[model samples]
Target: MEGLLTAETLYLALGMLACGAVAGVLAGLLGVGGGIVIVPVLYTTLGFLNIDPDIQMHIAVGTSLATIIPTSISSSRAHHKRGAVDFSLIKIWAISIVIGAIIGIAVAGQVKSPTLTAVFAVIALIVALNMLTNPNGKAIWQSLPDKLVAQPIAAAVGGFSVLMGIGGGTLSVPILTLFNFPIHRAVGTAALFGLLISLPGTIGFIYNGWGHPSLPAASLGYVNLIGLALISPVTMLFAPLGAKIAHSISKKALRIAFGIFLLLTSIRMFSGKLF
Candidate 1:
C-alpha cells in the first residue's frame, strides 16, 4: 500500500480523475459515458506504467468498461428525469444486449491487441460516418425495426460496444435517430444501453482476465480498482451537468459537434495503430 503512494502514481490518479470528468460529461451529453475517451487513455496510461503491450489494450478496454458502469447509470438517470429515455425500448433490448456483451468478451479474450485496435478503428470510423451524414437528426429510415428485427441489431450493438470499449451510444444513438427517434431521446435511451453493455462486459472481462500477467497493482483481472475509485465519483458529479447542457443545446449543433468529435477520435485511434 505504501509503495502505491508514489508521486508517479499520484500523477496517474490525477490523470484518471480528469479523464473521468470528461467521460462523465460526454456520457451525459452524447449518451456515451466516456468509454470512448477512457479506452485509449487507459491504453496509453498503462503503457506509460510499463505494463506489457501484449495485454495492455485488453486491460484498457476492460478497465474502461468497469468505469462506464457508474457513469452510465448517472447519465441515464439524468436523461430519464428529463423524460428522454425510452424504457420500453430498454426492456425489449436488454436480454439481447447482454447476450451480445457476453459473446464480445469471449471474442476479445481470444483476439490479439492489434486486432482489437483495428476493430476499434473500423467501428469508430463507421460511427463517425453515420454521425457526419445525419447532423440534423433527420430520419434516414422511416421507423425502427420491430422487436424481432431489433433483437439481433441490439445484440450487435452490445457486442460491438463491448469490443470497442464504448457505451453503445456511439452506435445506438445513430441507429435510433436514423429510425426517427429524437436525438435527445436517442441519446437518453443509449445511456441505458451503455449500462447494460458495460455491466456484463466488465464482469466477463474480469473473470476472463483473472490470473493474467502484466496487470497493474490493485487490478482485479483487467479491471483496475484504483482507476475505478478515482474515476467513478468524478464522473457521477459531472454527468448531470452535461445532461442539462445537452437538453438546452440545439440538436443540429450538438450533432455536428459530436460527429466531429467522433471523426477526430477515430482518426487518432487509427493513426496510432497504423503509424
Candidate 2:
C-alpha cells in the first residue's frame, strides 16, 4: 500500500478524491450522474501521469463508468428516499440502454484516442451550450408520443453513456422533463438508468481490452481499477452533501457553472492533444 503511493499515484489519488467529492455533491443535488465531471479530469490526470496517449480516452471513459456504478447507486437511493424515482420508466429503458452500452463499448475500443477526444470535446461543447440556454425543469413534462419515442431515446442514452462515460442523466433528465415528467422525477429516473448503462459499459470495456498488452498496470481493459477503487468511496460519501447544496441554490446558477466547467475542460482536452 505504501509502495503504491508514489508521487504520481498520490497526486492522482488526491485529484480523484476531490473530483469525486465535487461530483458526488452535484449528483445528489442535480440528479446528474457525475460522469461529466469525472471523464475530463481522468483524461487530463492520466495524461499527466505519463500513461500512453493511445489509450487515454478508453481508460478515462472506462474508469469513469466504473466509478459511476457505486456513485449512481448511492445517489439513486437518496432520491428514492425522497420519492423522486419513477420505477416504470426505468424498467422500460434499462434493456435498451444495456444493449446499446455493449455495442458502444465495443466500438469505442476500436476507435483511436484522437478521435475519441475530438468526439468528447464536441459533446462537452453541446452540453455546455444546452445548459446555458435552458437551465431548469421548465422543459420537464412536455408530453411525447408513447413507446415510439422512448425506444430510440433509451438506445441513444446507452450509446452516449459508453462514449461519454456518463450515466445518461445529461440526456435523460432533459428528455424526461420534455415529456412532462417532474424535474426531481426525471433526475431520479436518470440515476436508475445509470445502473443499466454502467454494468454493460464496464463489462464491455473489460472484454474489449482483454489480453491487450499495452494496457496500463491494474487495468481491466480501459478501466483503471486503481483509479476506481481510490475515487468511488469518496464520491459515494459526499453525494448527499452535494444534493443538500443543490437544494439551496438556484438551478440556473448551478447549470451555468456546470456549463462553464464543461466548456473549459473541453477546450483543455482539445488543446492537450494539439500541443
Candidate 3:
C-alpha cells in the first residue's frame, strides 16, 4: 500500500482511473471495445514514465488487453441486457480469432516497435475515417458465402486486434454493418467478439514478452498486471453508465465525435510525445 502512495504511483493510478472512466463510457456508447481510448493513453503514460521507447508499443498493446478483459465484460453485459448480441456470429468467429491471435502475438514479438506503432497508426486512421464517412453504420455488402466470408474476416479481426491491442469492435462493427446487420445488433455482437480476441491476444503478449529483462515490475511478459488491475474494475463499474448515455445520444453525433477523437488520438500517438 505504501508503494502505491508515491507521487508517481498516485498519478499513474489516477490517470488510469480517468482513462478507465472515459473508456467505459465510450465502450458502452460506441461498442468500440475501448482500445482506441486505452492504447494511446497507456502509451503516453508509459512514455512519461521513461519506459524504453522500443518497447512502448508492446506495453501499450499489453496493457490495453489487460484493461479490455473487464471493460469488454461490462460493456457486453449491458448490451446483452438490451438484446443486442448476436451469439451465432460469435460462435462462427471464435475459432479463427483464437488462431489469428496466436499468430499475431508471435509476429508482434519478432517485429520492431516502430513498425508496430506505424502499422497500428495506419489502421486507426483508416478506422476513424471510415467511421466519419459512414455515420449510419450501413452495410456495403448484403450477404456472402458464410464459410468463405466469415472465416477470413474473423481471422483478420483477430490478427489486427492482437497487433493493435483493440477489442476487434472497431473493425467488427463496421464489417457486420456492411453486411446489413442493424447497427445495434452489430455493436452488440462485436462486443462479444472482443472477448474472444482479447483472451488469446493477452496470452500471446504474455508468451511473446516472457523473460524480457526490461519489462517493468509487476508485469507478466508484455502485460502490465498492475496497470490492468488498477483499471479493470473502475471500467466495469462505469460501463453501464456509458450505456445509458449511448441510448440517449443521436447516432450521427456519437459517430462524429468518436471519429474525431480517434483521429486526434492517432495523431498524438504518432507524434510520440506524452501529453
Report, for every candidate in turn, its global Cα lDDT versus the true structure.
Answer: 0.87, 0.78, 0.81
Residues 64-165, candidate 3, lDDT per residue (tens digit)?
887887788988999899888888778888899878877888889899778778877888788789878998766688763386668988888888888999
Looking at model 1, residue 152 earns an lDDT score of: 95
Ranking by TM-score: 1, 3, 2
Q: Flag clash pairs in model 1.
A: 27-33
| Tens digits of per-residue lDDT for model 2, 84-117 | 7888887778788888887788789789877777
Q: In model 1, which runs have C-alpha deviations exceeding 4 angstroms?
A: 1-5, 273-275
Worst 10 residues of 2 by lDDT: 136-145
lDDT of 3: 0.81
Better model by lDDT, 1 or 3?
1
Each candidate structure's TM-score, on Cα atoms with residue i matched to residue i, is 0.95, 0.90, 0.93
Better of 1 and 3 by TM-score: 1
Which prediction has the highest TM-score against the true structure?
1
Model 3 TM-score, 2 decimals: 0.93
What 10-residue stretch in candidate 3 is worst by lDDT? 136-145
